[model samples]
Target: MDAATLLARLATVIDAHDWAGLPDLLHRDFTCRLVHTGEVFDRDGWVRLNADYPGFQRMHVEGLVADGDHGALRARVIGTSETGAELEFAVASFATVRDGLLAELVEVWADVGQDAPAGTRPQLT
Candidate 1:
């Protein structure tokens, strides 16, 4: 599959909680880096991490851009805790495709709706 199509499908499978379909879009040597945590995982490890994430409900792709074999995407992940509180995170990912499969991915995640740091910028008019 082309890079864009593969990435689009990636989000779909994850949102659907179809763990079995994830590996099909990954290369044999696939690697994923969690930029915020400084952790890295291979295909199996990455899949396991996502599958085991606590309270994971669904993932929604907010935006995507692709060029050649490289693509970048921003997605929102939502979950509900045991206490019934909703949580949301914004995840930004950069991915490289090799031989029509995802070879490498680097992701940075942050909580959504965080306020800007004090004095970082003036309020909008």
Candidate 2:
């Protein structure tokens, strides 16, 4: 799969909350780094976290760019917590593809502040 196709599939998985289908797009030794928390996670760790969190109500990709073997995407995620409070976050994701699958992912995200809308600018900071 090319970078665009892989990223598009990733968006679909997150939108549908289909954790079971994630492995199909990942390498066996895939690794992800959470920029904010400085946490490094393996493939299994990614699956577990996604399973624990309630799925997002909506995710809008604001920008996407793909190079030969690299891709970058910025999106806005909107969801409601268990307490029914609305939440919004801007997420910037970078990926390196190898052998047609995602081998590494680095994600940087932040909660949208009061001044921002649910889907605003890309959060690269």
Over 4 Å off, model 2: 114-125
Q: Model 2 over residues 1-125: C-alpha lDDT tens digits?
A: 87777887888787787889988898888999999999988988987776676846877888889997799988899988889899999999899999999889999989997576656878887
lDDT to native, each model: 0.93, 0.86
lDDT score, candidate 2, position 102: 89
The TM-score, computed over Cα atoms with residue i paired to residue i, of candidate 2 is 0.85
TM-score of each: 0.93, 0.85
Model 2 has an lDDT value of 0.86
Top candidate (lDDT): 1
How many residue pairs clash in all the candidates, one count each? 0, 0
Please write out the lDDT profile of model 1 over residues 1-125, one tens digit for every residue: 76788888999999999998899999999999999999999999999998998899999999999998999989999998889899999998899999999999999999988888999998898
| Residue-pair clash count for candidate 2 | 0
Top candidate when judged by TM-score against the true structure: 1
